[model samples]
Target: MQLHELEVENYRAVRRARLSFGHTTVLIGENDSGKSSLLEALVRVLDGGAAEEPPNFESFQFHRDPVKHEIVGPIRIRIVFREREAGEWAGEVYAPIHDLLLRAGEDCREVAFELRAQPEGEVVWRLKSGKRKTSDPEVLRWLREFTPAIHLRAGMLTGYGTETLPCAPGLCRTGETELDEKIAAIEVAAERLISKTSPNQESDLEAGFKATRELLQLVTLPRDRKAPNLARRVREILGKGIDLNSSQPTLPGSNTSSEKLGILLLIAALLRVARGAMAKEMEPIWIIEDPEAHLHPKSLASISYFLSDIRWQKIITTYSGAMVGSMPLSNVRRLTRRRGVVTEHRVDVTQLSGVELRRIGYHLGAHRGAACFARMWLLVEGESEMWMLPQLARLCGYEFGVEGIECVEFAQSGLAPMIRVAEQLGIGWHVLADGDKAGQTYIDTIRRTVATKDRQGRFTLLNEPDIEHCFYKHGYAKVYQEHARLGGKSTRDMDPRRVIQRAVQTLSKPDLALRVIEAVAADGSPGVPDVLQKMIRTCVKVARSQSK
Candidate 1:
């Protein structure tokens, strides 16, 4: 089964939010923006391992608001799953799910697994016919069969400093009662022989056996040193004689990126094994949080591609721009937190077809990749502003990176579609353009097609022809003159735009702008052009205001 949508209410930072899922969804957000909480909620509801202990108040309920004195809620998380139909197991295995069908929609069958926790700490699953307490064995079995989710959280691959060697052949295998019985008998016989021959070693052998009362603990390190789950897991791998590091066969401590990636890959491999055995019967849902942890940018790109190739549905959470840029923007879900409420927004890049995405990919080069991390977007007309805006912002006492504002060069393309993309992504955006005929025409089109009122302001323009004129209008003509010979051209008589264009012919616009900014910086009394100053102040204001 595939998760079609998720509805979470009064769950941690998310007071109320509904998120839809695709084959692959990447959750992008700032720290503590409820991305982890969302994944945790899914795990608690769907992962059978967590069903043993129902969530408590601290885990389920939202914090009470002191000012509002809000009433405690019955924290609820509902996951809608699409039933499998194409595979062979769809009939025998998933047929029972059809009986519990919540609906038969046009595209696919959907069933909701609703988990609700009361204020008194009682949790229940609302099944199709009626509510079932989470303690019910039947409910837990259903969750395992239908919604077996694999959660790969941060640090999952690390921190194994001490681990015991695998047990000898045919010993301490997980879930093998017959093999375990034979091993126990052999151990007893061996212990008796050792005790009779070497009395001094008898006590140590007995102590070792007593310390590990459980069979699964046979291949694990000391109890105090290993995590409980890892302790139980070592025996399973031990039975298979799979030495992770075959060369020198040492228990890894997760020092290298390759080792970390190997751990993630191992998990995916196990899930794939499970998926294949089931005849792709039940869709294996993979939830990976911060897969970029311990991975360099190149590694993250490879992982992103690897994840995209997985057959089942995947949900990944990340804080890295490279991670976001590497994936299809259509799969990106941006999470934002304001005050105490958290929400999710996804840009409708899905509206673009495959060919369209390819076209956009060409446009989204290195400079545009920066937009993945931007809190607000500043769409400029050409390469000059994309290069010059940051420097100009510094000159105006603001920092672009520090403020999380990214300037995108649209190459004089229409702003209407780009504005829609920003709106769908919940990014605060403003357009900067010249007041010429073309810029005016685009701005007028934007005013009609784009939602400017929601943005607080429409396009801000320089009344002069372009930024070069704005520089001349300000007192920067002398600064530009100092950098370029300008053929003794003065802004008073010559066309300042032509002088600026010619200067760029010798030196790139950004290089020339840098030279002027450096000269003005040395001068220490550089005038902030009206247009540049307005843009910087506006960026700062918008960044601050929307960030709140």
Candidate 2:
């Protein structure tokens, strides 16, 4: 079964929010933006509280109004699950709840699980099928058995014992009746031994006491006693015998890094599923938080590949840029909060054609995925602006990193796909274009892509032909003049623009940009160009507005 959708109300930072899911969903957001809360909500309702004790409704778990600072009541989390394929729900485990599966569409079956906190500080779990609803705990048990949730928290597998592998009984059990018979015999013998060792011979004790006192008569009181639970003892014995050294070559011992240990745990879980320990009718949903923790970029890419290959439904939360870039753009869900209310922002890949989708994915995977985390995107033509814009923004008293602005050089994938992605992800974008023909094309694309009302603030055209020319025309003419003389090029009677143009053609664009920024930093006389400063201010204003 796959998680179809989730709705949360008055739970933690999420006042009210609804989220849809696919087979694989990557939750990306800043800290405390409800990512962990969402995952916790899923674990609470679907995992059947396996990983944790039953949640006591803490006051902090309730949503507090940002303005009034008063906690709310009845924290609710609802989840919907549907079959991954048609006619796959034919197992005996699904028989009891067959009637409870609601018809979603053609060959589609769905069921909803709702968990609500009551005024008396108690939690209520209910299963729903269309208009029919029941609080029967048996149905919840059936749901968990049919499709269990595997929640792997961060660092859960880092410090594991290697002497005895902690694994499912199915992993170590052999299909033989002899082991069962021997365990049963041992249980019976142990119970008899306990009975034999008890003080049952009262006559012999009285004879021994006869010498001490002749007149005193001793009596032993008859008392009822319970037998020891041999079955629980057998389970405890079996738990210590199961180990992974024989199966997993590199066991996740104390020496294993947290990153590799997580991957190993996932693989072990999958092995259990493969070995028929888990139900075969539906794959378990894996709720993993920070799978990218302590992983290198290359390792993140490898893990992403491994995760994509698994057919099970996975909900992962991450803060790593490489992790975001490695996954498909459609799988990413960006979360944001304002005034103590969380909202989700995602790209609607359904509206994009296959080619457009591919283009966006290519850009994201090409190390531009960090743009998904940015509040604003400064779309530039090439690397020169990409390298120089942030420095210039700082000169104008705007910190790009602090303000969550990313300079995306969209020369490879063109402008349309990047703009579409930014717009869909709720990231504000502004295009800085040259005055040349290629730049005019960018300007025209922005006009056609962005709404007419938003075009002026989102698009800027430099007065000169390009960045090099613009820098010369604005305030850095002397820097270029000195560079031209050092390069054996006479600039005594040359046009100032032509001099800079020759310098750009000969020197690398990025190198020249660095030189110009360094010169401006040393001089500290002429500030950033007025047009560029205005553009930066406009980007900040538009980005913050869009975020709100």
Candidate 3:
């Protein structure tokens, strides 16, 4: 089942927030923005292995608001699953929960569950339907097993070496008498082997036994590979096998044709978990944290595609623009935290209005992924500005990219629609527009219509005819002339400004921007123009503030 909505309150860093979920939700946020906390909260509420103990009073309680908040007893997390469509699990295993749903007046398809942390070091879990709530321990426990949720940590790959062997007889097999009988024999041998070799780590062996039992209860194991045999093989190979953790692959290495070791291992770990889930006929909800850990750009793309190929539902937390770029903007859920209270913001690009879609279609199509991942965005007037501003800012010693700021083009279609989207997505943004009459009119209209308080202060107008005109006025025409290779060019020409403007218009924005960068590198003479310098500084300040 897919999560339709999630509401979290009194949890770590989250005071109160209601969020919608997609089939594949990508959480993007800066450090300490509660992206990881959101994932942990999901695991805790769903009993998804991450919560070893219920949250305590000081650690997980949300006490940020002083005036309008009073209840501070339990940390609450609730999730509403979407009404089951065709193709969802409708087997006998789920029959008991169907009764609970019907008893609580819930539609047979939709289910809502809430989990709360008690002061007595235990969790209070309940199923809700309309005004009715059911706390039947057996039903709640069964639901937890029925809806399998697995969290794939960044360290899950290297940590697999510690995975203990299944110690219970027929732990991974169910409803197959013949296979179970064979597995029962193998289990005896495997347990004897583990007991001999890892006697000092008896808990690990016992935990493995418990894990096998739990797996058997949750999933219908296929007979292809019995758990006992797999466990025996793992134990036998423990010392004889090559330790995968000894020599991990790093980027810029000898093997350039394939993905790095870390990414490969990550993929393997995720696949192992997926295989186990699939064997049980369950569509698992996999929570992946920082899938880009130790991955190069190419590897990130490959791994992202590999993830999409899986049948399981995924909720990923990421800080990498490359990974975000590989997915649709609609899947992104931007998280933000202020004074220890977390909030979630999402805007589906496909759901935008027709007019807005037309206005920002080019913007979204080209830069949406980068913008979504950025801590702040600098929305500029056209492609030329977008291409030029970041390079220019770098020349002034204020690197936009280093500050997690992305430059995006509004393409002169205006900024109102794009600004609306930015606001909805909770992206901290600033605009750079021309000082020409049309640009001024557009900015003024946006300032009046866009109710966002900081929009006016954030906008940095060139105070000249346009960006190209500003370049000409700053004596950058000589550099442009040098790059464009204009025949019979003269800095003191009759109309060098017009000459440079015409040349910039003729060449591609990216090509011209590269020329400008080369020109700046070749000669540091005029340096950054004062007006552009001021704007870059302002943008850098805003970008840094948002990042912090």
Candidate 4:
């Protein structure tokens, strides 16, 4: 069974949200955007009742209306579970709820239940299927056991010890008999010692205790009872201790760094989940928060790979770009909060072909995955624009990093895929294409691909053939002339365009861009080009408007 979807209402910061899940779903958003709250809601609804005491729904768990300044009640969390195959229902764990499973589509069955917490603090669970609803505790129990949800909070790896390895069930199974025998031997020795120290023994102390017992016959005296055996309690503490194979045999949490411990814990959890599934004992769902916390980039990639390889349904919340880049764009759900309501956005991979999807994934997962997190994307042709445009934006008093604007170089990866991603995610984008034939092709592609209502303020074409030519045309002729002279070429009578083109061909694109930016910064004679300045302003305006 896999978690299919979650629908939440008036839960903490989320006024209402409906999110669908993939096998390995990643939740990403800004701080306080309700990523943690969403995970908490799932944990509460799935495992709340399993505890010895019922979970208390605190007042703050209810959503507060930003405008009204009042808290709302009756928080609702509904979850849907889909069977992986028709035979999954035949398993003994799911047999009790087999009749309640609803037909989702052809050959697909699903079961849904809602957890509602009323204002008066009463929580109720109702199973829903095709007009038949019931508050069956049996269904809830079956659901909890069939797919147990485990939440690993941020920084939890450091708190674990060798005796309590998260994956001990799968990792340790060989030393039980030896441990039990040793514990029994110790218990026997402790019993012998207790007998020798007992007050019931016929010693001088026993005689004194008997005399006292005669005087206080109504009260129970210590002489009549044997001593308690304290060694029996050692059985609970003496089990297999996991050795991490370091210089010193110690637990990961005690000796290892947080980053290494995180990786180890994840590997252990994956093993346990896999083994449990195969043994038909349990199918656990992991809710991991910030698996990339304090992890290096390489370590982050390792965790991402582990997550992708695991077959069990898991949800991860992360704020790392490298982590985001490692995941498929289709599996990521971007969250945003506006007007006290949390909303989710995701790429509609259905619109992409197999080839296009692979291409996009390769580019994003390899290099440009961070673009998905940007509020706006400035699509450029190549590295020249990627490097130069941000500097220009800075001169215009708009910093791309601070403004959450990512300059995506779309030369290697085509523009259509990026446009599709941006449109689906509601990220404002502006394409800066040159004025040559290729540039015109990009413009035509945008017109054909983008919606009519979304075309405004989304593209800018340079008046010149390229950025280099634009610099020469827009009163920055001296910038290139100086470069030509420095390169041992006299541009006394050459065309300004030719001079700039030669400089572009002589120096690498990035190096030449750096030279131009340096010259512009040093001389301060020709400020930012008018067209480029306007383009930056337009991008900022579009980005801000879309954010609102």
In order, candidate lDDTs are: 0.60, 0.65, 0.60, 0.66
- By TM-score, the best candidate is 4
Q: How well is each residue in 122-150 modelled by candidate 2, as lDDT tens digits?
A: 88777787887777766776666556666
Runs in model 2 deviating more than 4 A are 49-56, 90-92, 102-107, 157-282, 484-489, 495-498, 544-548
Please provide TM-scores, in order, for all candidate models, with all chains considered together.
0.74, 0.76, 0.70, 0.78
The list of candidate 3 runs beyond 4 A from truth reads 48-73, 86-93, 99-109, 120-122, 155-267, 271-281, 348-351, 354-368, 395-397, 412-414, 435-449, 452-455, 480-493, 501-527, 544-548
Q: For every model in order, what is the number of clashing pairs?
A: 1, 1, 0, 0
Better of 2 and 3 by TM-score: 2
Give residue 478's error in model 4 in angstroms: 2.0
Q: Encode model 4's per-residue lDDT on 102-218: one tens digit a residue.
A: 544457677787778886788877877556776767666666766767666663332232233334433222133533343233223222322355343224223322222221221
List, residue by residue over 1-548, the lDDT tens digit for candidate 1: 66878888877767777788988898877785777777878776765444344555564356455477574477888877664453322466655444454334445555566777876767776544223222454655665655667665663222111021121222232244533453354344333432356354435334323332333334343432323333323322222233422332332323344433433333322322232122124455777677766555654654555455556678888777666767777788887877557777886666655655564555553336557657888888876677778887887788988898989766533476677667777777888888789788777867687565654565687788777767766667765555557666555577676667777777887787776666556655556666677778887788777677
Ranking by TM-score: 4, 2, 1, 3
What C-alpha lDDT does candidate 3 achieve relative to the native structure?
A: 0.60
- Per-residue lDDT of model 3, residues 9-30, tens digit only: 7676666667777778888887
Q: Native-vs-model 4 lDDT? A: 0.66
How close is each model in CA RMSD to the real structure? 10.9, 15.3, 10.0, 14.0
